[model samples]
Every structure is written in structure tokens, then in C-alpha cells.
Target: MIRFQLEESDREVGRFWIGFLHAFRTIFPGFGQRFLAGIVDHHQQPAPTTIAQLTNELEQKNWELILENSSLISSENWWSGFVEWLQPFKEKHSIVFLEDSGKMMRKAGEELIHGISPKLRIALTASEIWWPRWFSEEFPGENCTELWHKLRVANNIKDFSSEIILPKRNLLTSLQNQLRREDQELLIQQIRSMINWLQDQGEWLEAVRLMQNNKDFEQAGEILQDKVEDWSSSGADPLEVLFWLKELPGVLLTSKPVLCLSAAQAANKLGFNFQVSYFISAAENNLYALQHFSRNDKLWREMVLDESGTTVQGILAQITQIRIGENHETEF
Candidate 1:
């Protein structure tokens, strides 16, 4: 089969011609070759036989069939047939019919929204109606644009804060109430999947923020703990990690000595001497509490005490020496 090996600029035109030719063929079978022959110089080769051949010749020759045959291409019968052919083959061909016929797509989406139940409409519009690239420029309505902006801001850390977070949180809660029971469950599953994907991509802050937004505090804490462990083991940058640890709920932060030690190590790396002392003190206190109250908890002991049996006090001494400008390396 003939192919165009289309460039980025040519892809939309290519899809349009391919779709148009298929529509033309459906309307006038056995005449495609003759049409192709008439459109270009055919002295050396016989008229192209297949739709692919016709599309390739037209594109290679730089013939603008879409504009040349605009009337025929846009005629009601032809356009309908083109859409019908496009719907099934678009995915296979990597065709987004919307790029060429966005007005029609928008109209159809609006009509679909009108016909669906409110719950389904919200779910469908949020999940599918707005194309990713066109969200800011071509989004259909003001409300949609605002909602999309809020969603975007919610994911971003720089834009996230207590005052800004509350509005987005309330907006999300409002939208959640409009979704059906099953759709609500599906939305949660999708958010969870997105969180897992973010974590896999090493976007721990973004993942934790999403969990916190959804009120999954326990899961968020678990992710924070995992992030600390990852940094401790892999020697990753700890500045941002320490900041997040400082923001954790007081009760949660104080309950885990390993977390405090991780924060202390992070503070030490960033040259925050006061923070280093504070975190080390907190870790010492939490270690004592764990030893007295939960002696059976070997996991905390294993994490807090190094394999060399270095205690919290030893780690503190090492941090003190480093803070005093002593050229000594410290490990947590």
C-alpha cells in the first residue's frame, strides 16, 4: 500500500484526505482511479487503484484536494459518510477528527451532554469532553475553563497552599456529589491509579498532595514514610523532603523516630543547623517513647539503629561535629 510518511505538519491534512477519499469512494465506487488520474500527471504510471494510493499521490504531489474539493468534502452526505468511516478507523490511523472538525465535535459533545443525566454528564465532560491540549484555548464554556484551571492548580505544588487549597477542595467535593455512586467509585480508582503512577515516576510530593486532597491521610502518611526511606537508602536530595516532613501533622511526625531521623539527616545536608538540632532532639525523644511503650516493635529499632549499632545519641554527636565545621562524614 502507498504511504505518505507524513511529517507533523502533514498529518492532519493526510488524515483529512484519507478520510475524504474513503467517503468519496463510498459514494462513487469504481471511479476513484479515474478521479486520481484526473487530479495529477499520469504519463508514467496508470491511475492509482486504492484509496491509500490516491491519498499518497495527492499528498506527494502537494495537491490540496481538501481545499480544491471543499464543496464536495463538506457536503452533508459526504461529511456524514466521512465521520462514519473516521469513527472506527481513527484510533488505528492515529487520527483525531477533532483537529480538522473541532466545531462539529464541540457541537456533538454539547448535544451529548444535554442528553445524558446530570451525574453522567459531569463524569463524561470531566473525563472526555476537554482534549488535553485544547483545554485552555478551545474549552467550550466558562465553567469548564474555570474547573479545568482549578484542577491544574490543585496538582501543582507552587500554587498549593491552605487558602488556595480550600476552594479547590470544595469544588472537588461539589463535583463528587454530582457523580453517581458507581462513577464516584470509578473516580476514586482513577485518582488512586494516577497517584500510583506519580509515585512510580518519583513524584512523591504530587502523589501525596493528591491523597491529601482526597482525604486519604493514612495513605498520604504511608507515602511520606516511603519517601523518607527512599531518600535515606538512595541518598537523594532531602531539602524538599524535609520541608514536607515539617508540614506533616504533629502527632504523625512525632510517632515515627525514623522519619524524624530522616528529617534530621536532610536538615544536616542542607546546612540548616538549628533544624538539624531540633529534628535530632525530636528523634531522640520519639526513640525513647518507642522503646518504653512498644518494645516489641523491632521495625522501628531496625530503622533507627544502624547495622553498626549506632544509637540516636551517636548520630546526634556526629551531626554536632558536622555543625561545628568538623570535616567528618555522617550517615543515618
Candidate 2:
């Protein structure tokens, strides 16, 4: 008997096996209906005599018997009877035994395992079947990568799209408490990897959002700085930059004069007169905060004497000359 059982929750999977077997039987009717009869008769009667008669009727037909959900049989006597009947035919014919629970198999006794050769025993999990179908050759098993892949596939996220952001965030929130500790750690690693990949692809705003989700504000700030710098040079959509900047924590935004300056630039570009005035004031306030720090402080020294020799004071003076209605151009 080639005995194996699929993981729990696979109620319809038996039908697939049954259909395949029925097709095979249809292809070769000369093999007779004994195998199918034995399966049906075993289920209907489940008596020792029924098994014996089925065994005797085989007469070296070279057939295999498949028992689906055999563990579901509640009678210990039936199990014993089945085992006894199989002793003589063990080497002559193949019997496939299916069970849902290994605990039930052990509770029944060692006889089930001993009666069936250890080499023929197989256990299958739901993930083994389900994950492979959707992911094909790229399935990475049950890990953070698998979860991320599933999320990406489920949301059809080919690239960074605003439509999928909320759905993906909600899905992650739902899974936070449901996943195992190791899986959660794996998910964290996957998120970090995704953030790095987004940054590499120059999807800076998307990378910052992911870092924010991970609560890696420091990294998010660094990436946001890069994004602002890139936008300033590339003349990218400034409103988009302003929107993401507003999403950042106020403390983080106010701590960096460059961030505040970028917001001011974006507002000015978009012709938001009030916002331009507000962000410019915020930039000057942050610049004032920077000026008060000890000159020896690393942040103070970096802002005052950057590699390009561009100072926050210099940028502040340049921005202050702009009127609300004029097309003001400020450089960092």
C-alpha cells in the first residue's frame, strides 16, 4: 500500500485524486472494477470478511487499492481487521492509506506504521501544494519572502502604485499578530529588502513610506533627503514631494533644515502662496535652530560647512528675498 495523507483543510482534494483514478480506470477497463469495488465495498461494509473476499478475488491482478481518509474510521476493530487481512498481501499488492492526522495514527498504535513500510509513508502540507501553484518555480516556501510574494501577487503590484498602498498596509496590519515570531522577523527583513530595492530603483518616496511603516524614521529621513535633492535637480513633480514630506513626523521635518527648505521649494513650485510662505517660515525657524547648536557638533559642522561649501545660512538668505507672487528659484 502506498499510504499518504494531504494536510487538513483539503476537503476537495480527494475528488481530484478520485477523478484521476476514474479516468485511469476508464482508459483500461480490462484491468476490471475490482480495485474500485474494493474501495467502495470497504467504505460501505468495512468488515474483515469484506476485506478477505476482496483480497481473495484479486488473484494476482496487479492492482492497487487506495483508501482515502482512512483515519476517519472510528472503529479500532476495523483497523485491526484491516491490518490482519493485509499481512499476506503486503508484498503482492499495493494499498494506499490516507490519514488526516498523525496523532490519530499514533493513538491507533505502532501497527499502522509497522504494517506500512516506512519508505512509502509520506506527509503533505497545504502550503506545499497551494504556494507552488501561484508562485510556480519562484516559491520560496513559508517565510517572509513567501508572504511578500503572496502580497505582491494578490495586490497585482507590478510597480509602486498609490491604489495598492492602503490595501497592502491593511493586509500587513491584519497579519501582524497572526504570523509566527520567526515569520514576523522574516517579514521585517523582507520589508527592509523591499525598501532597499525601491531606493535603488529611485522610487524614493515609496522607499520612505516603507521605512516609515517599519518605524525606521532615521532611514526614512535619509531617503527623503535624497528624494528632495533629486527632485530639486531633476525638476520632478514638486507637489508629490510636498505630499510625502507632510506625511513625515513634525519632529523629523523640523529637525532638518534641508527637509523644511525642500517643502518650501515644493510649495513655491506648485504656486501655493500661503504654503510657500508657511514652509519658508518653517525653514527659517529650523535654520535658526541649527545656528544655535555648538559649532563643534557634527550636525552643526555638516550644515555650516558642507562638502560643496553651501551653508544653511546662505540658503536662508536666498529664500528670504522671494516675494509671494514672483517665480522664486532657490538653490541648496
Candidate 3:
């Protein structure tokens, strides 16, 4: 006898399987009646003998139905009035149900895992690349995030497997272009998470470029801050930094000065000589309050002078104008 108890969490998988069975009955004449009877009779007794008898009967002829039902069930959503009837066979029939269902069930993984035995859950998840499609269709904002965490633990996956599961870069670019304004942050976070999971150092630069090309400047700034030292110290293409700086939000200059400084340095490296002073002038022009700005004056001075053979004299005039304008408004 399959020693298992139906859990509340398994309700979705249970419903899908039961629905599949309900559909299965309509196609095969006598099989439905016997399947229904087995469920009812086995439930009333709740004993090992009844379960064994039902299992034996089904095991003998069920494989034939399972093979046929495999294709038939994909087109139907027939779970009703037979959930209890199929209770005794849940564990015994789980694999046949999942195997036959294919990607059709990929969208229902959260519910599906609950209805199966723990061991079966582990087996399905441990098989690499099995859960990614399901996850892509049902995760991040669908309230199935916990299920992803669970599957990761079960499968021994140490990090989020974006490289394995994420759609290609071009697809991501298209999605970004079509995504609504309010959902931009969601896309940013997803891409940011992918960037963090990357193992190859060289790929980080490419990933940053992709984010910039997709116009995810906020995320691009994040990646720049994360890897700016490596790229700068290694003499990577400073034009990449200049490119991001061109698109980056002015508001981020005050809020994230390190990124601003990095962009300025990258621009300076490429002999865009005035970017450091330009950056400071732009920040003062756009930002009224630098109270929360965290970058120190010393770092700002260093970034302004480093290799550019330039000074912050022009930026200082812009800064004085901003302060005078703000003070005049206060007096008014």
C-alpha cells in the first residue's frame, strides 16, 4: 500500500489529477465507472485490503488507460465530484499523471507539487531544467515565489538559475520595450538578480550593456556600481561607462554619487575630458538638496582631477548659483 496522506497544500495537484481522471472517464466507457467505483468503495472501507484490491485491478489494466489518457487529458480540465473517489490512488497514479501531462502542467506546478509525495517532488525538481519553464510562467509576482524557493532547496540549487531558465536576451529586450511603466522596476529586479547570479566575470560587462540597450538605466547604474572598480582598473572600454552616463537619470547623480563618479572617470579615461565637471554641474543644476548625498568632497575632488588635467572651477560656479538661488527663494 502507498502510505501517504493528502495534504492541504496538495489541493491543486489533486484537483488537476482528479480533473484529468474525470476527463479520462468520458473517453473510455467502462473505465470511468470502475475508476469511480474503486474510489468510492475504497474510501468507505479506508483499509489496506481495499486499497490493495483497487491498486491490483488498476495496475493490471490501468497502464493501457494511462497511455491513452496521457494525450486526452491535456485538452480537458475535468476535476469535479471525483476528488474523494481518486484519493486512494493519488500516490500510485502520480507519476503516470505528471509524465503524461507534459508542459501543459508546467503552469500548475505550485499546486501539482503539493498533491504528490515528497519523494516525487524531489525527483522532479532535482532533474535539471525541469522547473524553469514552469517557474517562468508562474513565478516572481504570481504568489508562487515560495514554491520556487522550496524547489531550489529540494534540487540543491545554490542560486537562482536565471541562466538556465531565463529567455534569451532578445526576448528580454522585447519584453522590456513592451512592459508598462509601473512594471519597469519588476523587470529591473529580475535582470539585476540574473546579473548577480552570473559566474563569468567577462559576462558582467555584456550584461551591463544589455541592460543599457534595453534602457534599464537604473539597473545599469546598479551593475556599474557593483563592477566599476574591476572594469576601471582593468582598462575595459571606458566608452561603455560614457554610454551609460549619457542615458542615466540626473536624479541618480545625487542619490548614487559613486556611480556618477565612476561614469565620470570612465568618460575621462576615454578622453571625454570635461565629463567630471559636467557631471557635477549637471547634478547641481538638477538637484536642489544635497543633504542626503553621501559622496565626500575629497572623493569628488579626486574624481574631478584624476587624469583629466582639469579642475572643478567651472562646476563650483554652477554650485554657487544653485545655493544662491535656493537662499533667495528662502528669503522670498
Cα lDDT of all candidates, in order? Answer: 0.47, 0.48, 0.43
Specify the poorest-scoring 10-residue window by lDDT in model 1: 37-46
Model 3 over residues 1-332: C-alpha lDDT tens digits? 11122211113332333344444446544443333322211112223453455456565454323322233233333333333455665555653332232333333334435553432233232212223444334243443445456545444233435544422222222223344556555555545444443424356655665565455667777766676766678866665545444444455543554555565555444444345456545555433244235276644443442232333443445445544654575598
Better by lDDT, candidate 2 or 1: 2
Write model 2 residue lDDT over 39-141, tens digit each, in one string: 2111133234434554555564565666555554424443454456566765877766655323332333222223322111111111111122222222334
RMSD of each: 23.6, 26.2, 25.0
TM-score of each: 0.39, 0.44, 0.30
TM-score winner, 1 or 2:
2
Better of 2 and 3 by TM-score: 2
Give the better candidate number (2 or 3) by lDDT. 2
Worst ten in a row by lDDT for model 2: 119-128
